[model samples]
Target: MAILTIPVAYLIGAIPFGYLTALWARGVDIRTVGSGNIGATNVGRVLGFRFFVYVFLLDLAKGFLPTYLFPMAVARFTGHAVPQLGVFVALATIMGHNFPIYLKFKGGKGVATSLGALLALNWVASLAAFVGFVLALVVTRFVSFSSMLGGLVFLAVYFGRVDDPWNQEHLAMSVVTIGLFSLLVVRHRKNIVRIKQGTEPKVSFRKKHPSGRVAWVLIPILALVGAGAIYGLAAQANRRSELRLQPYDLTEVERVGTGHQRTERLAYADHGKLLAVTCPRYNRVVLYHVTKAEQLEVARDLELEGKPVAVWTTRDRLYVLVRPSGDERHVKPGWWRAFDLQGEPVGQPVPAGMYPDDLIVTADGRHALVLTSGRGEGDPKRPAPALEVFDLGATPPQVVGRLEFDQPGDDPARIKLSASGNYAAVTLLGSNQIAAVDLANRERPALISRSNLEQSEAPHLTESKDDSILTATTPDRDAVVIPWPKTVATRGGCIACILPQGAGLTLIDAATRRLLGEFPLRAGSLNLGVARPMGLAFSPERGLLAVATRSGSIHLIAVRDRPENIGKHEHVAASEHLGRRR
Candidate 1:
């Protein structure tokens, strides 16, 4: 089904609106006109100015529809990110306009189609391209010269945006940009020769009659005013749409004690009965009893030596992954500490990893999964983060097996062990992929497979073999991991989307290694601002999925059959905002 995007886009681009307009309006073939090309300029020579406008707009739509709308539809339908795939569709549309097979391999110069494509891909770059065209045309009055310059400027403007995700992950966008630029230059070869010989035809804005010149001046002014008014109204409408997101009522606010103000990670324990929140500021793990209404009641604070960064709980045990405080003069290392469900110390702290970021206990509480963010290049031996499995049945948890990533920068942010303790879904922030580790093999945990998230082009980095595949953008603070219910048919797990940049949640099928759906994070009454997903917990029995943000706002989304579809209610978690609460 996804294979038809390119062919469909190509057919749309090959419509030849200019040729048809010339034939219908003047009974003359546009290909034999002034420029001997079936484009807006040649068609305008044979047909009236009105016909030229109609032909140009039709040509533009051919490129715009397939590039802008079709790929998104396909991506949504497929569940996987077809980002670079969209670039292919865009390129195909432009190529069809340039050398259409329907016209016996002869077609327009692709300037209009390219403009439409760039406009759809990146509107700012398209505007920049238009400015280049207008500037060049006004100075030289040569349409061919202006078209070539516009295409070049479009590429330059689009590529210059180093910060855009599309320019970074989708390297194919660069290829298309260069291809469009080259196509324009190659198609304008005759005009280049004419310009060099000082015989290029310059467009005369004025007609032979005085009234035609007056009409031209009046028409441009009217068009500019109409365009401005339309733009103003559209901008107003967009603002209204943005604000229309329903705001959810504040549900609850769990505050920290004095000096324990900075809070970090959140975890569920004892079948969703307990919520253990890590507060590094006071080196403690604060436990809470979560009510049915999704409110947190402070249960107890378990103090630890090192700073608590992440926590996980079993039916009878509490596991806290702690990192050494920077103020330590003796240079204490990072380790793991365990305690009973009642918050009593179980045993002495054990050596976990260099920088433990997240952990997940198995359903039976016999094993655990830990994700450690690597200590950077300062240390050569432990330069990369790893997925470590711990045998919890032992007195102090023992590291049974480990799987480290090849890239030193592959910093793992979160980990989720499946209900049956079969697999551990690990989100690697640095690499932008979710590595699913098979935990069934306790003696040797293996990295069974991985799935990429939706990603934009990473333009700054050199292209690798894997760069062709589109993945999700990982914000510095984006981290959420939730395993699917064992009873549910869905294979793997889901994660909260990186907000503001890539807004939505991504659900992946662990069994097939396929994306089930990319669901938006929009709720009934809440507007998602710079809401980074800091924590995620699923209530399968109640069909509720709760997402906690660093903005101190927790959003509850209802799920039906799958995470791909959003539920009825979504709102702020607590009765009061975290900042306002005592």
Candidate 2:
């Protein structure tokens, strides 16, 4: 019953309203015509602006329905209140719009879908994104550029004004929403190329078509039906389950810095005896000695060539990713350096991709994997999404092999290596796919397989959203989770719009190079917080998994225990407040 919700939501979002509208209005495939896109923009260009508005609203509904209405329906049918499940449904809806399985896994740019989802998830941020889009569109007269800029604005506004900006509560949601911006930027790569070549088309405001009556009638009918179905499900859910909001216990919460500097990344090193945190504004890695009692004291700060973005540590060495400073004209495009345990330079700086964001070192300290985002700074055409493997056994860990992807902006963002270093799994953020490489053979790493994290099955209309009443069998004990609602509220905003789920983690079999499964982390979990998993470190000695969430806290999970037994400890650079528990 609980599992049926995501797939059902995906199917609902998979409807190609724009493409269908264009095909019905005129006998032309929207993908083959202007812009070669099936989005509302392309549909509008082929048909008319008035028709485009209809398609846009419908596309937005695809995103809105699943997040706003589907959750209540699932909760009603399953008799279980899964609040964080809405995040999964919302993401699935956006994913369906971007990569609809029915379209042979080829879909739109997802700007409209993401905007709609954002509206459902955070109206404030959605409004910001909308404003950015309109302003940029009016100024540039280019939808592609405006959409990309709008996404960036959305990120800025979301992180700036949403709750406590630097807390762990918003970290996971921020990471996920930022990924939406990345998706938009990556998808619009070709458009950027066209703009640079001075060949991009400017949007034209055309008149409305006279035959838009069908769309108007159909859209209203569909909305009414969707609303009624949602209401019915809500009644069922109300009768079955009661919302039980439990409180999460925090082990300890302490401020890190002076609240002036931002805490970017946290890592446990020296066999979990030392904690390394990257504070970019401070332009240094602050080392802290962790006592057996879990108390942290400032050890020292290692100043770097530039602002540190990420860090990886071995038995006796530390690796840092730094973005060159503006005045440092001598620094090359590559960025990464190695240092000894005492914070001494190991040798020369290692050459990496355009923008290296994440890195991981094997337990044996014999190999290291670096994800170079390849998306060059200041230039959209300079995408070099690549994975650089280094032989750590070498004097300064020489770059042994480089693995590149065929996709233009398929940047390997988050990377993880197995405990034994037998295999490496990388999340290609741009494509919503994961790639596994056989790292057993260090000299020549082999690409094992690439799997899309998102489900590949195309969503199909399973039931009528306008179904006024459900059959008696639907109330049966074994009935599947019905997706429609009896009544959907027409109010100020959506319920989940202001609420978002945390980031999720998926497991991959290191030896087999296959994905095991996905596990929901933050949000709806017993841990009532958001987790932006920046780094993963497994300590076999302590039987604990140390996760460096890009926030003010570090989450520790017992490898041998259940998820509910996991704990989150907040520690910032601020030493003024210590030993505080929440």
Q: Top lDDT: which candidate number?
A: 1
Best by TM-score: 1
* lDDT comparing candidate 1 with the true structure: 0.63
**Model 2 residue 148 lDDT?**
94
> Candidate 2: lDDT of 350?
77
- For residues 1-582, write the lDDT of model 1, one tens digit per residue: 557888888888988888888887778887876777888877766676787788889888888888888878876887665536667787888889878888997999998888887788878778878988987776567989998888877776565442222323435676778877887898899899999999998776776534446757866776797599667645532331111111211121222121243345666666776767666655777777766765566788778787877777766788888888754512445788788767788888878667677666777777777777665323555646788888877876788888887664577776655545666666677567777677768769888887774454220111133221112333233434343444332322343334444555444322223333444433111121223455455555444455554433344554434323222321122112221331
> What C-alpha lDDT, on a 0 to 100 scale, does residue 467 get in candidate 2?
20
**Per-residue C-alpha lDDT of model 2 across residues 337-407, encoded as one tens digit per residue:** 87776677888887665767677777877777887765532345555677778886777668887777656
- C-alpha TM-scores of all predictions: 0.44, 0.41
Give per-candidate clash totals.
28, 19
